[model samples]
Target: MIATSEISPIATLSMQISAVLVWLGLVFLTSNILHRFKQDPELVRKVVHIGTGNVLLIAWWLHFPTWLCVSAGVTFSAIALASHYISVLPMLNDVGRKTYGIFYYALSITILVALLWDRFPEYAVIGVMVMSWGDGMAALIGKRFGKHTFVHMGNKRSLEGSFAMFVTSAIVMVIILVLANGFRFRDLGVVIPVAAIAAILEAFSPGGTDNISVPLSSAFLSYLLESTL
Candidate 1:
């Protein structure tokens, strides 16, 4: 892996610019296209949710500097916050809905990148992917196929949704572990517990805070468990 410092100034700038373009293109174009088609706003939200999270893959592949990732997170968190009031990302925030999922999502990314990018980026990937795939799929599946329901902290959730979260979290954890440590059955010790914890957190967290709780817990727990192995 080429160190970020060794890359020439022009190359670094180019990469940063490319990152910005990709992110903006994804957000703006998706919102506009979904709006134009008059698709379900929820669909637009989920598409953006899953799509934007893939930027982490880009960051990981490109070896984005910690500051760049953190700055993007902070910037988007601010945008998400502003979007709560103004109609600034209509596809993301539903009108008159009290949910800060988008904000928490960005903040979690910021926190994970700041904490783990330098020494353990794979953990950061595990964290964000769990949130991106796990929670995103849980919401989608819950909305579509959530037949059995229960309420927690005044928030209703479906068993199907929770199961989706757990399964996705486990799959994400396993994939990252396999990529990072090769195929090892012992990693199941890490994947199972961490995925269960992620599911628990997602089920209990109310008002979309699961975005923060799920990823941070999954990543850090994975880190701790892997250390023991």
Candidate 2:
């Protein structure tokens, strides 16, 4: 006869591992399909970025065990680091730049999920949302429509890109706030400043560290200010 406690642990481990595999498999499969079709590398990267960050939403909605989210973050972070040295996922790392954005991105998710999952899951979602949508849009729009350019902290950025980040970040906050707290206009007090700061962090963070800075700052600021309100 087997003990229920033993069975419970086994079940949990199996579920978490399966979820991680599915999540990672989908992202990689999509990226490879896009790569096969000769799609833009940058576009494929952004798709992976946005799609990867969104797993947090599934974790949040399904109330996944904290260990699951943390483990997923750690696993992805390791894979991102490994991909840098190998052509394991060329589409993700062949962006023609020397940046650790993907690694930092996975690290940020790990940190945020570890810190905010139990106490403030909503803030975790907000953080990932801002980073994924805000930063992703900035890169895409910046590359396509960015004409007026200036250098900030050794990174060339356009007014257009910065605006995209700010606007998307603000909208992301508003949606999260309304869903989490039932649509209060006063939430703008938190949204505007957090969005502005997230943009600044994304702009100034060198070597793609904005993946860490923007999301952490956005999540913490949203939590701190929202607590006051």
Candidate 3:
């Protein structure tokens, strides 16, 4: 509710073109890689879930509003969170290769609705975008070259990777905030507290699903910051 003015239709439309480009690049590349590994159709759908979903979902932020943006975001995450506790969690113990992405399908649908709603679509888009790029890159880079991990169980995540994601996400958030004139670096005394919250949200998310939390939380936090400042 802090800064819900609509961005220029042309400018907003521009992110859509980029969204398509992101989709094409992610699909072709991920599909080719999965083919090399001989992944099955189910597995392929899952991969598409992350690579394709991340970009497309994030790209939706080009539009800005109040209810539409926040609702789509809230519902998407609520579904995902629901599925996790109800449908997905029960199956987690089954122990299979393609186990992770199904519950996310529910989450994705919820987020998709959140993104399209006219009232707050822009905020939804920004949150989704940050989670997409920030969380996705963290996983990719961590797997490839994560020498120093912070946690043990998923030694999969690393300090270096998290730092990368935190910085990348915050910088983007700053841009979103800046152009809107909603808030500025100068206003928040120390932006790290806010930025750190964003980073930690992604770092601790289930299966890189911070795509749901990061933006919604950040938007709310940013809104809080806007008023307090």
Candidate 4:
């Protein structure tokens, strides 16, 4: 971990701002390219979404300060909110509903970085990874191979999608926990329950709300499990 004392405040702020700008630019460019090619907008959106979340792994790996991560999250959220209002990024807003998911997604990222970055950074990464890989795969698989469906809160969900979410989440959490906390029977205890909860939340969450629900739930469960152990 990089000591807070090692990084000057100005340097941290500049780095954070630059990273956010680059990320936003990439999102804008990628969206336009996908549109130009007449690609599957939903798939492209989820790919970008998952990629955006996973990029935090670079920050975590580099031992960025929590404040820097929080700043990036805030900056990203502001831009997303502006885009939502003005339709500046049509690809991101190409979803079925008019919602504040981008805002909520940014909020969740900020919360995880602020709360878990210092003490349990691995958990933070795990939470976001589940949101990224698990959620992303579920949507992709659900759309392509979702024949058996059920309705939840006026939204259609598929058993295949939920299974995808659960399996992916479980695999991610288990691997991360094993690497970070060591492979033990106790770790399995934590992994199973957390993955199940995350999958359920994703299944029930309507529209873009899963952006908030999945990571938050996974982070909370991971924290609780770690605290007890």
Candidate 5:
């Protein structure tokens, strides 16, 4: 039944048209972004390989059970993020730079799958925020202004980038929560704490692929807090 109450012609058409335009832009602009790191073929391969799977996985998260979906998504991403240490840990060269893209794809897809399968749409948005906005900012800032170095768990990373990631990720999560609640920011009870925990993970995680870990870890931490408090 095509209910008149559910249909807004202008709004629907505008959103559809805008979505199409955004898709087209991404299709073409991806090449330019790839070109920036064209000299690094291995990195490109890893990025493309991971991205291929990740994007598809994320798209499938809209139909799952809420809590379980997010929990599974977090678990999957945590595995991917923690996997490298147990495997042949590589150097954080351009190779490492590209590694993040793959990690992002993997974790993003995991969460997306969880969202779709578990009907946990809330976590899906959270996952994407950590991946796209948080991860992206970390790398960009790390490359541009990262000078202060720190070693943790046998990994070399920067404090400046850590701060950037923490602030950016927290802001994104908070903004998402605010907007999700119709700008009623006061209703953000546990989400605010969860976002804060996520920021801390963003600042301290040595995975180099914090994108992979952030969403999954945040989700799990959310579950933990919800259970205890």
Candidate 6:
């Protein structure tokens, strides 16, 4: 991990830009391959969605400046919105016309990154991980193996999926906190509740709004819990 004090703004900015381009290219390539093979487009979209969150981990490791992360988020959000309105990038557009979850996803990411990139960088990482691995795996598991279902906001939700989300989010939070701050039994008091709250938020969120709600809820609770403890 780069020391926070050692981060060079100019170098970090260049690295951030390059990382964005590379990540986008990978998403494009993955989308094309999935489309060509007649794979489930929604599955492909989730894979890309989950993978995209790693950029936060990369930035955190490099100790990137808050401005660069926020700028990238804004730029990406604009591109995503443009694609939605004008078909500028069809590969990234995998949802229906009525749902603005993708836009919300970008906006939520921007907000969390901006809010947590400074003193609470670990919260930012936890938020992205919950959104990525927890949410992504839930969809994948729910679609493939879900047998029992419940309704939330007019949408069918699987018990299995919610369980996956809770487990995944909790496990990822523990792992991240351990790596960044060392393992402490006391931290579980914070981690467990944050994971549970985030999972519930994702399960109940209508349309794609979970994209916004899950991370925001997770980050906020994590921040709040950490601050109090």
Q: Summarize candidate 4's per-residue lDDT along 63-173 as a digit string, tens digits.
A: 677877888889878977897789766787675767777777878888899898998888888888899889888888898899999988777778899899999998988
- Candidate closer to the true structure by lDDT (higher is better), 1 or 6: 1
Q: For each candidate, what is the lDDT?
A: 0.84, 0.86, 0.54, 0.81, 0.52, 0.82
Better of 2 and 4 by lDDT: 2
How well does each candidate superpose onto the true structure, as a TM-score? 0.91, 0.88, 0.56, 0.86, 0.56, 0.90
Q: Would you list the clashing residue pairs of candidate 1?
A: none
For model 5, where is the 10-residue window of minimal lDDT? 56-65
Ranking by lDDT: 2, 1, 6, 4, 3, 5
Residue 189 CA error for candidate 6 (Å)?
1.1
lDDT of 2 by residue, 1-229 (tens): 1223445676856765666569868987888899889988888999889888878876676566687788878988998888878876778866678677889999999999999898788899999999999999998998899999889767888889999999999998898888778989899999999999999998889888999999999999999998898
- TM-score for candidate 6, please give it: 0.90
Over the stretch 1-229, how does candidate 6's per-residue lDDT look in tens digits?
8654555667766776787678868877887788778788668778678777878887888777788889989987897677668876565565444467778888888998888888888888888899988999898898898889888877777989988999999999998888789998888998789888887888898988898899888888887897789
Better of 3 and 4 by TM-score: 4
Minimal lDDT window, size 10, model 2: 1-10
- Model 6 Cα displacement at 91 (Å)? 3.7
Give the root-mean-square deviation of each candidate in angstroms: 2.1, 4.4, 7.5, 2.9, 8.1, 2.1
Could you tell me the TM-score of candidate 5? 0.56
Query: Which candidate number has the best lDDT?
Result: 2
lDDT tens readout by residue for model 3, 1-229: 2222466656655555555566758775776676567655434443544454454344344433334434544554565566555653332223233333444544644554454444444344445556655666666666567798776335346877788777766666666555546665564432455567877876777654555567567655655665677
Cα RMSD for predicted model 4 = 2.9
User: After TM-score superposition, what is the CA distance of residue 35 in candidate 5 from its true location, in Å?
Assistant: 1.2
Q: Residue 98: error of model 3 in Å?
A: 4.3
Task: For model 4, state the Cα shift of residue 108 in Å.
Answer: 0.3
- Cand. 2 Cα-lDDT: 0.86
lDDT of 2 at 48: 89
Instruction: Give stretches of model 2 more than 4 Å off.
Output: 1-24
